[model samples]
Target: MEIFWRIFDTLILAGGFVYIFIRYGIPFFDNRKKGIELSLKKAAEYEKEAEKLYEQAMDVLKEVKSEVENIKKEALKETETERNNIIKDAETAAEKISGNYINQAKSEIDKQKKQLFDEALNMSFKFMQDIMQREMTSEVYGKINDSFLKLQEEAFDRRSNK
Candidate 1:
């Protein structure tokens, strides 16, 4: 009777376990597996999206770097142009100043030459007037008349000797 009771109890416990597994455990496990699979799919999609975003960011960074290099080159070119323009302007200004200085010096030299000529002319005129006045005096005239008389006497003497 004891062994019969043990077997009977064991059968009842096994039947209850089977019933519970069929009623709730099967549905619960199936839903959990589907949820895990959906999560895995979502994770794969997110990884692909993240990879595309990273590639796009790298491309944009490269474009930005290229733009920055272009800007730097342009700035250097403009700076060089400005430097050349400044040098040209300075050279032009220096040439103009030099030309003006030369012109002014030439003009001054001409003016001084004219002034010296006029002063010399005035002195010459004054000397000529003084000498003419002295020559017009009676003493200088008598001297000139004596020189001509001597010349005539020498000429007559030379003719008589010949």
Candidate 2:
């Protein structure tokens, strides 16, 4: 009976120690687990913040690309407009030059025509005066004059018929 009593008492003491160890040990480890979980949560928050910053950077890059394209388009449009203006100005200048050349050619042709007309009239007047002077100083001056007058009348009548 004494031996049984001693064994029972030792068992009870051992069970009590086990119970204390289980309860207090579990709470202490739970505090460490909570700290680890808080660290993990902070890390996830930082990851989310980094993702937001990356998204903002991407958006800024897109805006820069759009602005560059707009500037290029504007530059091309302005260059095209300037080119068209240059072409128009060149065309107008060429037209004016052509018009000036045409007018000069017309003026030259008119001057040549007037010169030819004056020469023809002067030649005809000289030929007719020579014939009249030769006929007036003949041996039979009156008869020669009368005959020349008759020939002149016949030439005038032929010209009128034509």
- The number of clashing residue pairs in each candidate reads 0, 0
lDDT, residue 32, candidate 2: 83
Report lDDT per candidate.
Answer: 0.95, 0.92
Q: Which window of ten consecutive residues has the lowest lDDT sum in model 2?
A: 131-140
Deviation of model 2 at 48, angstroms: 3.8
Cα TM-score of candidate 1: 0.54
For candidate 1, lDDT tens digit of each residue in 105-162? Answer: 9999999999999999999999999988877888878998999999999999999999
Each candidate structure's TM-score, on Cα atoms with residue i matched to residue i, is 0.54, 0.51
**Candidate 2, position 156, lDDT:** 100
lDDT of 2 by residue, 1-162 (tens): 999999999999998988887888778789989988999999999999999999999999999999999999999999999999999999999999999999999999999999998998999888878987776665668787889999999999999999
For candidate 2, the clash count comes to 0
What would you estimate as the lDDT of candidate 1? 0.95
